[model samples]
Target: MSEDIEIAGEPSPPPAVKAKSRARTPTEIRLLARGHTKAALKVLVGLMRNDEATPAVRLSAANAILDRGWGKSAQPIESGEEGLETVHRVERIIVRPEDAVEGDADPKA
Candidate 1:
């Protein structure tokens, strides 16, 4: 139930078109930076090699280089809800020497 009409001897304008912006995926972003990989690594290495830099800064740069070279080490996650600590149950069983032969829990056996 829509109609286009001429007003004041002028035709109506067309609907507005919105510009679409798409985010680059991780792979795409990495590809974009691939060209700068060498320079970036060089900068990191320079930072790592600079004795003037603080020990922590140097270590950070070294870690970054190592991460890129050999991938990052696996990290373990300890998940627990806020205000609560995660706990696990452990079970222990004791068997006497005689129980080993008959597989009985009775001490007499």
Candidate 2:
């Protein structure tokens, strides 16, 4: 009875806090940039589609649209095999002059 009363009087432990993920991910950055690009493209399309706009302004907008597709060069991604170990084999060969002459008559001597 006393132990139960003491336990009841004691406060419970605080709950465990979850660790926060503070680092920005590549996918998150890409999505954010995509949103900004889409917003810019919407404005550009509006400029190109407006009839009141000058031909030069509309032409510039049209060029912007086409440049997005073919202006930038393609980037090649470098990739290599993972979890692979390379092994090299080495061999040594030695031949002495006396050993070579032993097989011959050594006519010069």
Per-residue lDDT tens digits for candidate 2, residues 1-109, read: 5543547567977789899989889999889888799788988999999999999999999889888967955675545877566669898988665678556766457
CA shift at 43, candidate 1, in angstroms? 0.3
TM-score of each candidate?
Answer: 0.48, 0.35
List candidate 2 stretches off by more than 4 Å.
Answer: 1-34, 72-109
**Candidate 1 per-residue C-alpha lDDT over 1-109 given as tens digits, one digit per residue, 9 for 90 to 100:** 3365556777668889898889999999989899899899999999999999999999999999999889999995666656567679999999757558654575654
lDDT score for candidate 2 against the true structure: 0.82
Show pairs that collide, candidate 1: none
- Candidate 2: the clashing residue pairs are none
| Model 2 root mean square deviation, Cα atoms | 17.0
